[model samples]
Target: MSPSFCVCRVRVSTGHCTRCARCASSASRCTRLPDPELERGVRAAHVLRRLGSDFVVFAEPHLKASNMKNLLQKDEKKEEPEQTVPCDHKTASRCLLNLMPVVSETVSGTLLNGTFLPDICLEVVHDRELSKLPFAKSNLTVVLFADISGDAIFCIWKADDKSTLADTIQTVVDCSLNIQKNYGEWPTCIGVTLRVKIGIATGMLEYHFFNDDFDNVHYSASGTVVEYVRNAEMLCTAGDIILTTEAWNFLEQKGVHTRYTYTALPEDMVKVLCFDPSVTEEEKVSFTSAFAGVRPALYALNFEDAPLLKRFISPVVVNIKTQEELIFLSEMRHVTIVFICMPEFIDIDLATLSQLYRIISAALKETDGVLNKVITFDKGCSFLAVFGLPGYKGKNETCNALMCCNKLVHEISAMNM
Candidate 1:
């Protein structure tokens, strides 16, 4: 017969092999056997240890291999399923981690932006006050707006004489503090250390706010304005008021002149030497009137037959323009009424106008006979509706009118997309 290969069984607790073709009398002698038999013996021992005292050991090699494979498959079946994390949550986590170090730096920059408004106000106030002094108008207006050791500082000086500038700046600073104390509006917070830097700019009142052509025009300080202020501030020491070359030139022309102590600027800084000073007050009044007329017209459309409109319409005149738009509404009594002298026609496409009308009609239908036909003149003109007399608002006429108008505008705008 060919050499028969037989598996041996070993008891892990007793460290003894049961009778088989590979068994040895002594446990230590088991290692002396042939390599093939020794491997089979070791594998058997492992299996016996895992199965405990009552496990059956087989002499067949094929059965042992199949059993080990089944054991591993069973172990894998007991594990929980893996979960997926959302992309947005993961992205937010990454962003917060990256921004952690820079958060303080960003906050410091934002604080600087808020300080710009207050600083400008201080400089203007100081300049006006100093100009009143004898012979001070001819020298440069060096204004410093800063905080020193938690005290708000406003300093004004003239650069022509260092001793005079120091004396004037000290005097002005004292007066500014007294003004704040009297008004209960100190510039600095208590218990916090603060420092101020000043910028000196001199010129005629070349820049001013104006209302022309129904639009308000003020100094158009784009991104460049903030940058210039920041550069000037950076060059200044705690009490020093620094000025750019452009500002010095304008100050010289305005009768307040300064000798440059430090004169250098980055190549990118553009000099804003002059600006126009003009405004039209008439256009502002007209614009206000136009807005007032349109506000009520829009409000009336929102609340039809509302008690408020009765009180509201008496004081309001819909026709704000020289030429009025007209609206025709069909009444329940079979009489057609016209709303004359409406506001100017609104410019809208036919499709949008049709949709707006549909929304208004649907909203009115909800209130029964309180509202009926609505007629609007021109594409975007105010609407005319007969409320309560023939339809929806008859019983609740006081409130229904306003309610209908409000709902109509809201629903119409919602469907615009």
Candidate 2:
């Protein structure tokens, strides 16, 4: 028999059961108590009969009452509401919903301690001349940093009259892809959005550097320049580049002629006006001097290296071919020295050899010598040095190399030059 069906003894006294209301209403005798061992059987039979009656009650229309209570509990949970997440331009523009994988990959490796986005925004603004009147362009470069979920939006004016907004965005996408291909690995999570906002303004390039830490700093642009750009973007329609009156006036003063309406503010409305002629002049001189100095040095480096030279130089001021030729011509008057060292072959001291290698390496670095070759053999002969490289700015790499090479040459000349 099943464990639940095991039989047990039960005693019943009908005379005593009729005196108790609970027992009298029952069909079975209920007044007699069995021994503790047999009580289990009595309770089981009573429970079965009560359950049968309960089952019948549950089958009636009132069964829905329990179900309705559960549903009401569920409804209360539903009515409790959910929290909304804050949105940002970065998330809004380049989210997976508008995923542009190529753009994301392009800016992924940019070193941003929170400053790359702002710089990129300024670059886009500068490139498009958004500060100019009638703003004629509506292109933007969006840079998103995944770690901080921060975004930077840059708008360009007058990219192409024939292109649609989508085409302009695609152009930015293509540019970003090219950047990634040329510059090595970028952050996989970094994203880009294009042509999302149009901005135009005319103002001085105000500079500020944000200190991420003692070792990290990022440059930013702000002041009236930022405000006007944001205002212009707000006033602009989708795919339209807009400019503020201040930006238009600034462009006019800069000799940029454009037809655009302007609204003059009351003199009292102006809050701040500060000018620094020294700063502007300093910036002009610095840029001019840097280009003047670097151009000549770059030309010389390219000229001496020729076919093997392309890898080391950057493409600026001219195309690779012209730059190479210019550098080659500049090397016509330059001289190159090669130093090779040979130590004694007798005892063959490995410690001395290691020390000598370290010395040569340090001399090369100190002299700014780009070590082009190193060849050593079993005879204790070492060939090391550089050729056709720029002098170290102040590190004295050339002098250091010459001094070290001379010492080694004097020591080894008796054995072998």
Candidate 3:
């Protein structure tokens, strides 16, 4: 007769088996040889041990993968060539371009594909005050700021010499039109309508780098020019592209031919540009063809090298061990938003900043809060955290958020001493 196998949770180590209390009575009679079903059950038990009951839902997949090898073979067979679907090359390019900020390497391919924005770095002085920086250079730049349904912010800027003013104007016009037309049709946005608001500004920008970490250094820019674009972006309605007077004048001066029609916003101060419903295909081709050969440089931030950046955006990334957390949190629920700002944090020494980050990270972890976003300015830094995600239905999220904030204040204050 085949040896009886125990279906209870088992922990195997050093050629010995430790059984849970529930199965201890049958431990002496259980078989210990390899069995696919037994192995799958063991894996699920281990997953539950490591990730807690919250991940019990994900364990089902591990249990079902008892025949993973055969499943992989079936998947390989499905990869055989089949009839292809026609796709829009331009729309594909735009989609890839939109992801440039998140996936750094794609920036090169995106630039090579079309007349996109040029490469430019906004420098921030690290571990030092900008007022004391001895050397700085000012460049006339056109900055473009895009807000995607309040989910993410994309900022791109180019110096005047990188490309002609006509090319810049044409590029933004093309961008605005593409977003308005194809954004909702994309696979990720198919069921939802995402609003894309754009703001453009042209002004003098001052930038410089710091010597904090030579191996992984980043630069930042200063000047009211950034604020101008940010304000213009905030004033924008869905599908609206607001341009500052300076930016508008640059296009007017360059005599750029665009199919967009401009109208002064009903307010006394802002200028708005909208797609022209009556634009002829001939006119679109006429303006778009002028920059047919344009290839602007694309310099994107390397997120892999930035540990702080990774930590701040950790909630959005899924981990194999705790992927269920993300899956469970991906729904709408009431959450307490916590915004923390460190004014003049740019001048803080790297050592102190590292300590502060650790303190805040520990506090948030203790309180079960999630960091949603982070932004670094020339003189300051701010981060957004949320509590009471969908998965934690029983926990008092507001209490957790308040506790986290209280701990941050105490810890940060002690650190400053």
Q: Report every candidate's CA lDDT.
A: 0.27, 0.26, 0.39
User: Across residues 103-222, which tens digit of lDDT does each residue of candidate 3 receive?
Assistant: 222222221111111123212221123334223456766666656555323334345574465566556555545544544122232354445666776676655333221122223345
* Number of the top lDDT candidate: 3
Q: lDDT by residue for model 1 over 81-169, one digit each (tens)?
A: 22211112222222123111322211122211111122222233323332221111123333433322222222223345533443333
What is candidate 2's lDDT per residue for 1-417, written digit by digit as tens?
000101111111211111111110121122222222112222222222221111001100110100111111122323323222211222212212211122111111121001112223233333433223111212221211001012122322223222232333223222222222322122232242222223444333233322111121122222344444555444433223334554334344644222222233342111111122332321110111221121121112222222222111111011112122211111111213444535343232333433444444454444444333222322233443442222221233345556656654544443331
lDDT of 3 at 135: 36
lDDT of 2: 0.26
Candidate 2 positional error at 409, Å = 67
**Per-model TM against the reference:** 0.18, 0.20, 0.44
> Residue 258 CA error for candidate 3 (Å)?
6.7
